[model samples]
Target: MTAVVEKIHRGRKFDQVLQGARTVFLRDGYERASVDDIAREAGVSKATLYAYFPDKRLLFLEIALTECTRQTEQAAAEVEDDRPAREVLLEAAQKIAEFKLSDFGLQMYRIAVSEAEKFPQIGRAFYETGPQAGCGLLCNYLRQAVDRGELVIEDLDLAANQFVELCKAGLFNERLLGVDRKTTAKAIEKTAKAAVEMFMARYGAKVDA
Candidate 1:
């Protein structure tokens, strides 16, 4: 078994190689994907692909899960910090739900799980980017909301994780288990709204009588 490389060796053909691997991984998944196939798709020589990735696992991580962190990172970028907690939290929840419920997101997760037992790093990296980073983002926004007196929460960490879970509750579970495979604009909005309402009900600062 090969050790997972945390850092990618980025060269001139880096994006080209990753683009190829992305296509193959999304299509063939981790276990069945072939380096030769990826190299062919990339239009690079086998030697060149090996020069950049060294092994299939490294390439898989780069294309499948590592860069997903880069993609999922904009969850809070457009959301203003001063916005009402309900609005900000709703936006954040929607972002989480959209990504987690997306086809790409689902693929990213499946690849991580399929490879996790053999490569623990895959699981850690997935959780770090998926749940941990998401929770951190929510914590930042929730802290701002608290500072603004929009919500009253004693445990910021718990609240952040709870909100993330709320976003994933129904449809995410269904889709992950293959019980329900479709996600729509309507479902995303509904999940986000419900998560925000529950969060606000639990934490929204009350007015004095």
Candidate 2:
């Protein structure tokens, strides 16, 4: 993880730059956002912005990584392991759907894919921090469910990854491809329910059919 840690000219305006970048990135997306826009959003000079982050990619990466961890924390914090596997899983599904269709998540995904060829680290790091970390969190909960006889999964890792993908099945593609700018809450809820039901169909041992 430390291997890809970007070196920056860290200073007083470091947090300010990060906050500014987040605002612009969410508003303008990866490609449209410029250094000047970020600087203006942050209320810092370009010299100060460049002083903290030498490259726009690095700035975006930092924000994406932080958001990734925040997403993970959000899921972990809200989901109580003591609950029935169905409840926990539904909550997880809802959270995953929320993130994938979010402005930050969509833009980050596009930026990582677009930059991967030129800066391989960007893609690798984003996936590692985002999807991979997400899978790992799901795996922990899934393993517990299996142990409790709530789920009968043979492959925790694969099942975890599959569940994450299932969460994205509805509006994710349309949103990613620029087909839909605003996804409805009803769609997201429907998708989350379907994902959990499908997952339970394969893995449930004690769960209701």
Candidate 3:
């Protein structure tokens, strides 16, 4: 009988490549960074890197997708407590803002936005995997809250998308410009409170006269 060759699942190897590519992209920016540098940093040969990703653009897209998915998942998982629906949304906004303003997170945002014309897929994937995913998760949570008689929302999905847009208003615009600005923890907290207040005033279970 002929011996069979064992399949080598290469998840860990791909992760190393992603980290190396992220480092090179950050250190040199997108235009100046070369695949050779990434391969060296990843401790893999050029051929191995090619085996994992067809080209530099694809590798970068993978990085964006991976990072976006991580942040979105973290935000969805961390949204918590028995607070009112308004307050819960505010806390969720803060967590999302904090994740969005992170170092690697910011870098991912820059590459996605700046080179979006060059790599439209990166920006599209970032939206689809990150904000869209978060919106869907928030919608599910809101549906649960509605079932429990918390928020008086009639349309959970629309409400979720609007909530994300409101949070992004204070968080996304600044980060996109690559300015010398950062979102402080206090600022994020305040922004979160504002999101809840604004949203609740429009659609809360209770409305003050």
Candidate 4:
């Protein structure tokens, strides 16, 4: 009982540190965010912060991975195996596009991109945890769809990447460039539909009634 309580306490402390790191990283970016700031934000001592996260980069990676896992799980949960390929693909695209354009997503992306040149590991971590994980989930869904005769994907991996890129369409670039950031549901739906249409044009299998 004592051991379990201690374990739970440690878990809570870990989470507290992560929450603090996330706030600091978001506000100051990776380059400017300091361990001291994160410790203060977390309401923990510097020693406690260091005990949980040895370095700032590892702390940042943990935060990124946690967020990525959350987003990936949310997207994956929305995929219905019994649904038609078009519907599933459209839903996935809409979720991806919406998340990419969201404020939190945009901020996280900016931090990753800004630090990528100086810290390549950060970029790699972001890619592996974010896009790569997302692509992998989509690829699995596509493979299942193919087996179910819903899609005819020759290269599941490539198709997954292309489908996601299609979903981004004009939204991601525009948001990244500061040209447009106010994405509406209508726009997201339209992008999803267009992506599904184009993707189905190439890989969708014809079904008999």
Q: Which candidate wins on TM-score? A: 2
Model 3 lDDT tens row, 13-87: 777988999899868866688999999999998888877777776677667677667766776677674666766
Give me the candidate number with maximum lDDT. Answer: 2
Question: What tens digits encode model 4's per-residue C-alpha lDDT throughout 75-166?
Answer: 78877799888878877888889888876687778767887888776787788889999999999999999998888888889999999889
Per-residue lDDT tens digits for candidate 2, residues 110-156, read 88889889988878889898999889888988888788888999989
Question: lDDT per residue, candidate 1, 132-180, as tens digits?
Answer: 8768877887888888888899999999888888998889888888898
- State the C-alpha lDDT per candidate: 0.78, 0.86, 0.72, 0.81
The alpha-carbon RMSD values of the candidates against the true structure, listed in the order shown, are 3.2, 2.2, 6.2, 5.6
Model 4 TM-score (2 dp): 0.79
TM-score of 1: 0.85
Ranking by lDDT: 2, 4, 1, 3
Which lDDT value does model 2 have at 103? Answer: 89
> Where does candidate 1 clash, by residue pair?
none
Q: For candidate 1, what is the lDDT? A: 0.78
Q: Assess the local accuracy of residue 181 in candidate 4 as a C-alpha lDDT between 0 and 100.
A: 57
Between candidates 1 and 2, the lDDT winner: 2
Question: Cα lDDT of model 2 overall?
Answer: 0.86
